[model samples]
Target: MDADFLLIRKMKQGEDKAFDLFVHKYYKEILTYCNYHCPNKEYAEDLTQETFVRFFAKLSDFHYRGKTKNYLYTISGNLCRDFYKKVKEIPVEAMELTEKTEPMEHQMTDVVNKLTLEWALKQLPDEFHEVLILYYFQELKLKEIADALKISLPLVKYRLKQARKQLERLLGEEEIYESGSKTCEL
Candidate 1:
């Protein structure tokens, strides 16, 4: 059996240390996922902690539907959605952003691009944004993303394609063909 199953088994047998290890392994990842939504480190940390709490509470009900990492992401996503609903965050625009230091040409361009990209990502529908974050930013495989999102493989593929197209449109890509060909590999 794989290590996932082994870890689950240990946790099921009431091994506190195993669960602690599991939490330790995924803590940083879950926090990072939350940060993609909230941007504030403290808020993301709270969301991450809540994700772990919810996951641990529902551990027995987890019937090996997918990997634990994906499950945690799903929980994190849901919590973030809830949080955003209440606060209705407005992302900062690229032009409105100030430089942190004297930036070289490449670094300035990179920062502006990243900020624009983040804003563009927010412009996308929540589902599309989630898929893009999972596939591109988090570097999850299509299949893994599918499993994590609890959707079919084809739907995941379709959403990813649509997200890329939407991003290119939002960013005003000159070469549609070249942008479409990007598979978002890490």
Candidate 2:
């Protein structure tokens, strides 16, 4: 049985400690997911909170129909939709994204490469970007990616193939099948 099943049982049985453990375990991961999708820190945090609030309300009704990760993403995705509905603002653009500071390297080239890659990732479509980030940045296996994204494994592969091609084309690279660690100048 999945850990979420245990967590669900504890939650249904009104175990406060188990609920705290569940939040501690998944809060960062869910936040990372929300940030990736929404990109606005305040909005993402709000969505994360809403997701858990809904999750708690629906906890006992939770079915193991999908992976727990995907369930969370589904909640997050819906919140993103609702957020846009309420705010009615222009979506965050990649060019507008500022890089979080890192240690200054001797060469500026690496920094540029990293920033360029981040921009490229932000520019990708949400579905493709989610799959790529989960697979590479989050270091999840393909199966895990399928679980997290709630897509079939074959669909995940197809999206990964398409995303890699798109990234390669956007980065103007002749080689299309490289790892995420490879620096793209664009």
Candidate 3:
């Protein structure tokens, strides 16, 4: 069996160490997912913690049929949706620059493009935005995204295709696509 399965079993048996190990393994990933959905970092951290709390509450009932990581994502996604319902504001996050040997001009252009893309993504409907975030930002496979979102694989593909088209229109085909090439790996 996988480590997750073993951890879940130990957790069900009231092993605190197993729970700690499980949280340590997934906290960063879940926090990142929440950060993408929540505008405020503190609120995002709260959502991440709440996700873990809810998961732990439901642990006894949770069958180990699905990957624990996907289940955490599912919980976090739902929490994010609920959070937006109350706040109803989408804000762009500041881009962080890493040290690179590239020319300053190139770096500036990249930052501008990223900010523009983030703005365009915010303009998209939540359904489309979530799919793109899962597929690209979270780097989940299509199948994994479908599982986390509790949707069929075909529907995931459709959303991804439509999201790409919408982003292209919002960013302008030329700006988002470089000589018909995708800006980021597809």
| Model 3 agreement with the true structure over 144-168: per-residue lDDT tens digits | 9998888999999999999988887
Stretches of candidate 1 off by over 4 Å are: 90-111, 174-186
Best of the candidates, TM-score: 3
**Model 1 lDDT tens row, 119-148:** 888999988999988876577788999989
lDDT of 2 by residue, 32-88 (tens): 877655646777888998999999999878876647776877788778767757875
Instruction: Give the TM-score comparing model 1 with the true structure, all chains together.
Output: 0.78
By lDDT, who's the top model here? 3
In candidate 1, the residue pairs with backbone N, CA or C atoms under 3 Å apart (3 or more residues apart, or in different chains) clash, namely: none
Question: Whole-model lDDT, candidate 2?
Answer: 0.73
Q: Estimated TM-score per prediction?
A: 0.78, 0.71, 0.81
**Candidate 2 TM-score, C-alpha based:** 0.71
Q: Please give the CA lDDT of all the candidate structures.
A: 0.79, 0.73, 0.83
Error of 3 at 103 (Å): 13
The true-versus-predicted C-alpha distance at residue 41 of model 2, in Å, is: 1.8
